[model samples]
Target: MIHTHEVVNQPPPREGVDEFATDAPLVEAVARWGRAGAVPPLSEVGVHVGSAAFQRDAELANTHPPVLRSHDRWGVRVDEVEYDDAYHRILGAAVGAGAHTSAWADPGAGANVDRAAAFLLFAQVEPGHACPVSMTHAAVPVLELAASGLRDEWMPRLLSRAYEPELGGVGLETRPGAAPRPAQGGGRPRVAKRSALVGMAMTEKQGGSDVRANTTRAEPTGADDARGREFRLTGHKWFCSAPMSDAFLVLAQAQGGLSCFFVPRVLPDGSRNVFRIQRLKDKLGNRSNASSEVEFEGTTAWLVGEEGRGVAAIVQMVTRTRLDCVIGTAAGMRQSVAEAAWHVRHRSAFGSLLVDQPAMAAVVADLALESEAATVTAMRLARAYDDDADDAERAFRRLATAVSKFWICKRGPEHAYEALECLGGNGYTEAFPLARRYREQPLLAIWEGSGNVIALDVLRVLDREPDAFDAFFDVVGEAAGGHAAFDLALAEAQSIVREVSADAAGAPVRARELAERLALLLQASLLVQHSPAAVADAFARSRLEGDGGTLYGALPPGVDTAAILARA
Candidate 1:
C-alpha cells in the first residue's frame, strides 16, 4: 500500500548535512503508510514493498552473524560492507553473516606460488578483504606485470593467462587509459563518476542479454578497409565489452569452434580496423557510463584461447563478472540502507522521533534483515570457489551466487522505498537519497546475471543425479539426522523436484518455471528440516571467501562442460 497520496512533501531543515536538503515527502509518505486512513496509490510511485516471498528471502539473508566491523579498516562506508571481501565472501556473509570461502584469484594472481596448489586446495580461507573494484584491479598488476616482464617475444601468449575482471554495472563509467579516475565530472554531474569511462557496460540490449540465444555473429571476413589487412569479424556485436578497446575480446562461431578472437586495432600503418560504435546506449541508472550497440562489419581478429572453446571461455569471463556484480550489488544496497537509516534516526515527525514510530521501526528492521541475508549467500559462494571444492559444493556455490544476487537485487530497493516513505515528501524529491535508491534498485536484477539465470543455476543442482546432489547434502543430513521432521521434509522436497522434473516434457516454458520451483523448494526445505539456530550458525561462519569457486582458473568439480565440438 503506497502512502504518497496522503502525505504532502515538506522541505528538509536546511542546517547541517541536511543543510543542502529539500522536501520531506518520503518521511510523510511512510508516516501515512502506517496511519489508519489511506488515499489513492500514487500514479507514479508503486512498489510491492509488501511482498511476503521477497520479505522472507530477505529475512533469511540477515540471519547470519556479524563480522569484525571491517568498514573502518577498509575505508568503505557501512553501505559497501558486503563488497569489502573480494568476490563472494562479503556477498555470502551479507546473506547470513557467518562463515566464508577463500576464492579470489585467477590462474596468475600475485599470490604465493607454492600457495597456488594450497590456494587451489584452501577451500576454507579466502583473500583479504578488498572491494570488487580492487579485486578486478588485482588482475591488472598480475597481467600487466606478466605482460611487462615478458622477453618481448611471448607477450601475446601471456594475455591468455591474463585474468580480466569484468565489472558489470548498469552504467559503469571510466576514461581511456586511466585507473580509478575521478568521482564527479564536469558535464552532467548526476552520474557522480569522475572517470570518463573508456569502457562502459551498457547491459540493456538484444534478447535482454541471453548469451545462449545471442545472435550477434563474427563470421570470417574476405575483404579489407581503405588500407588492407586479411582478418575476420563478420557480424554485429550487440554488447561489446570494450567497443572502444584497442583490442576487443569478441566471441564468435568460427569454422571449427565457438571462439574468442582478440581483434587488434589496425596499427596506424595505413591499416584499416574499425569497430564503428553505431551509437552509444542511453541507460537509466549508470548514465555517465557508456555502452554501445556496435556493428563489427569486417573487423580484424586473432583467436585467444582454443576454437570451439568459445562457450567455455566466455563462461570463464562471465564467471569473473558474475561475482563482481554480486559484490557491487551488495555495495549499492548497503549504501541505500545506510543513508536512509541514518536519516530516520535524526529526523522528527508527528511530535515524536522518526525511529520511534512503530511503523518506522518495523520497516527499518525488515530492511536490515534483507541486507543481512544477501551478505551470507554471497560469502558462502566465494568460499566454495577453491580448486578442490567437490562437484556438489561447487553446484552449491553457483546456486549461492544466484540466490544471493536474486534476493538482494530484488529486495534492496524494497528497503529503500520503505525508508523513503519514512522520509516523507522530502524522500520523493531528488534532493534526498531515497529517490536515487528507488531508481537504482532495478539495475541489480538486470545486471551481472538476471533472475532467470540465477534460478536456473539453482535448478541445475536438483536436476543433477539426485545422489550427486545428495553427496553434498548427505553430509548435512548425517550430522543433522537427529532431527526426524527435518530429514523427512528434505526427502519430500527431493521427491517434489523429481516429480517436477519427470513431468517436464521437453517444453522450455514449463521447464523454466519448474526449475525455479525446484530451487525454491530446496531452499524452503532447508528451513523446515533444520533448526533455525543451526542454520543461523552455519550461515554466520560463511563470511570468508573460501568456498567452491575460489580456485583461480579451475571449474568446480563435475562441471562436465567439457567442450563438445559445436557442428557448423
Candidate 2:
C-alpha cells in the first residue's frame, strides 16, 4: 500500500551548523585581522548564538513583541514596556557574553574588532536587543566627556557584565534621605546598580535628521554641587529607543545651544523622574525592542559636555552606532546565506540536489560573495577603530564608515530577499528564519541614518576633511595593482570624488552614485587583498567589471560556485 501522508522531498532542519566555524568568511576575517587572542571567546559565543535554544528564543522574541503598559489599572501612568521572557533571556546572554562592554573592559590591540565580532555574532541571534546594547556601548565614550565626578560614578556601572532589568516603579516616591548622596566627607556619589544600559532620545516630530531644529529645552537647576551640574529638561522626544534603560543620552536646547544630557529614569531623590513615555511606536520591525515618544517635564539630567557642543559630543557615539549598523546588516546577510545554502545542499529537486543545479548554484554563490564582501568591509572598519594611534587609519575610518554604512545597509534587504528565494516557499513563511531576516534587514539602513543621509555624510567628509578622503583612496589604492577590474573601478571612483569635491553645489545630486561606486571599489579592493582567490575573482568580475546584472544569481560563467558555497 502507498503511504498517503509521506513527507517526501523535504529537507531536514538546518541545525547544528557551527555559526562561527561554518562562517569561513567571518571566522577567517576575525582570525586574520581581529585580535590575536579573541577567537576562543568569539567561538564560544558563536556556538551559543547558533544553538537551538538561542534560535528558538529569537523566534519567540519576535513573535511576541513587547507590549506597552502606558498606565496601571488605577491609571497610575506607569509607562512600562513589558517583553516576553525570551527577550530578557537573549539580552541577558548577550550581556553575559560581553557583547556590549568588551572593548571598554579590555582596552588593547584589536579590542574593537573583538567587540565588533561579538556584536555581529550576538546580533545574528536577535537584532532587537542590540539597540540598547549598541547604544550602551557607544555611550561610554560620550560619557567620558562628562565631568570627572559623573564619569567616575557611571563608568564602572556601564562596564559591568551583569544585566539588570529591575525598574524603580513609577509613583514609588523615594524618601528624602533614602537616595544615594556623597559621603559625609565629600566622597563621590554612590551608584545603585552593578550594571546599567543607556538609550538615546533624538529626532523630534518636526525635524528627523535635522537635529538642529529641535525645540526641546534644558533649564539649569541652580545647583552647582560636584555631583555634576543639574538641569531640568522639558521637551518631547519623537523617537526614544529602549525607554526602560537606566539612563539616556538626550539632546535638548540649553542656554548655550543644543547640548547632550544624561537623563536617568529615577532621580537622585529616589523618586521617579518626570520622564513620561507617551507611547511606544508600532514599528515595521525591531519589535523586541521599545521605541517610544517620550515627554520630559522637569526631568533631571546632567550635562555631558559643554553646552552648545552636543553635536560634537555625540558624534563619536553616532559613529560607533553606525558601525554597529554595518555589522548588523552583515550578520543578517551571513545568516541568510547560511540558511539558503543549507537548504539547497540538503533539499533535492527533480533528480539532483538544489546546490547541484546550475541555476541554484549561481544564486547561492552570488549571495555568498555579497555576504563575504560585507563581512570584510565591516571587519576592516572595526580593525581601523582598534588602531587609534594611526592618524591615517582614523581618517580612513571617518570616510569609510559612512561609505560602508550606506552601501552595505542598502544591499541587505536585496541580499536577504535573494537568499530567501533560494528556499522557495519555505523561505517566505514565518516558520523559516528568512522572513524575519527580510524584515530586520531594512531597519539597519533606516536606523542611524537613511541611505541618502549616509551618502551625503560621505560627501561631507570628502568636502571638509581632505585628509580623510585621501586616506580612503590610499587604502583602496593598495589593491589596485592586483586586479585590472579593481584598478579600473578605483580610477573611476577617484575621478568621481574629484568631480564631486570640485562642485560642492552639485554634489548632493550625485551623492548616492558616488557613494555606491566608492563602496563597491572599497569592498572589491579589500576582497582582492584578503579574500580567497575564487571569492575575490568572482567579486571583481561581477561587481567591478560590470558583468553583473540588477538581480542576484547574475554572476558570470567561470565563477567557482562550489568554493563559494562551501564557505557559506
Window of ten residues with lowest summed lDDT in model 2: 182-191
lDDT of 1 by residue, 68-121 (tens): 222233353211112111323322221111011112223222111111112111
| 10 residues in a row with least lDDT, candidate 1 | 559-568
How high is each candidate's TM-score? 0.54, 0.95
Candidate-wise lDDT, in order: 0.39, 0.86
* Candidate 2 lDDT, 419-536, residue by residue in tens: 9988899999999989988989999999889999999898888878989988989999899788888898888888888899889899999999999998998999999999888999
Question: How far is 558's C-alpha from truth in model 1 (Å)?
Answer: 44
Once fitted onto the true fold, the runs of candidate 1 whose alpha carbons sit more than 4 angstroms away are 1-231, 241-247, 264-273, 387-391, 464-468, 471-492, 506-568
